[model samples]
Target: MVSLPEELQAREAAARQRMEELQAEAAELAVRLERARADLSRWEITRETVVQVLAELSAAEAVPEVVARDASDPKDAPAPHGIGVMAVPPWREGLVAGVLPDVYRDIVEIVADAPGPLQAKQIVPRIRLEATTAKIEGTRGKLKRLVERGWLDEDTPGRFTLARHYGDTGRVNSR
Candidate 1:
């Protein structure tokens, strides 16, 4: 065996110390990572619990309904950030597609100029859709969306009446 010099022995000791320090640092990092993982799991459970409780409260239909805000709440309370759910309302796509072929805003204006209810059948021919136009499934679906969104309501199911905002008298008879 080759003999180690005094300097070589000192170097070996220093290398061993460095290896131990590195191993200790690596161990500490692993422990911290595990803790972070546990904390993340805990936070996920917390989110799930909050969602469940909110959904149940909304479903129960209590008087002071605790509805979940579709947007972010303040870091503190009482601040509103966003609007409506990410889930599209069931009627929205069909409504958009139905109105896509027609000049919808113009039609709203046209009907607004009229005093009485506009029947679904009555508004059909008023829509101007060329054969090449993208989507013209029927105006019925779009009309239904307007009703659902509270822009219009049906005096009868087939016949839709406009909201007070339609004509701009600026006064809704609250009765």
Candidate 2:
């Protein structure tokens, strides 16, 4: 007959072995998650750029040929408005969230609605993105860009909040 202590020891050893295996698997998954995140970030940026370019071209096409010829200097051309065309403009008096690109506007709305400053990881799930390292990093980049543009304030590293001067509820003509 087997001793109880002996059986217990064997069970403990088995459990430990299983734990070690799971830990190894977890580490491998972490590596894969990182790679996937990088790819996702690249694709997201590329898609946004392409969308913006197409919108610009479409807007330019809509202009009357005479108007197009009149604005020989691109500087004199009216800036494209709506959808992907406008990058986050610097926040100013009377500026509104509607002016931002869709993703940026969503980020701002999320931050504005939050009770306090939030990290990119916290905001990622709110934006309906999977809470992955790549998503967090991509969100962090957008938050930083908003800060640079004066649309958001990063009071602490990695934590974002709406700029004080930016009105979370104000109405402005979206362009």
Candidate 3:
């Protein structure tokens, strides 16, 4: 029993109020979504850090045993093939590629063959690994390890080359 124009105005007011409520709810949800994304980013970083630390721990624990066994019986020592337990010994004056695990040796050999320093992405294809983000990052880690162990040098950041150049006579020359 209201006038038609008055009823239309009342309905419009209600619709506008409902729209404001929905807008407020949407704003709140957007804030929550942003917070969740931040939390997910932190958790992803934490997981990656934990996995790297655990791998280092496992490598550290296994090193002494590999050393002892290799020292006791050189020939009887397990063939260094996989990356898991096959430790990369620190480079020495007389040490050769034979000392490294197969994967590491492949890296060293590839670097040695290259005309100049190479990036992890460049090395990935030579090593027969897919040129994916994960593969490149993993190779970068191995390249860093080689740098740390004195097997490779990082003269410029993110580029790797051999620490010592191998001569035609199979002798190592300081680079």
Q: What CA RMSD would you report for each candidate?
A: 21.2, 6.5, 9.0
lDDT by residue (80-131, candidate 3, tens digit) is 5333443677887667776565567889888888889999999989988667
Can you write out model 2's per-residue Cα lDDT over 106-158, one digit (the tens) per residue?
88888878889999999989888778676788789989999999888888888
Error of 2 at 150 (Å): 0.5
Weakest ten-residue segment in model 3 by summed lDDT = 166-175
Poorest stretch of ten by lDDT in candidate 2: 166-175
State each candidate's clash count.
0, 0, 0
The model with the greater lDDT, 1 or 2, is: 2
Model 2: lDDT of residue 24: 100
Between candidates 1 and 2, the TM-score winner: 2
**Candidate 1 residue-wise lDDT, 109-143, digit = tens:** 54665677786566756654322111223356667
Question: Which runs of model 3 end up more than 4 angstroms from their true locations?
Answer: 1-86, 165-175
Candidate 2 residue-wise lDDT at 152: 82
Deviation (Å) of 64 in candidate 3: 11
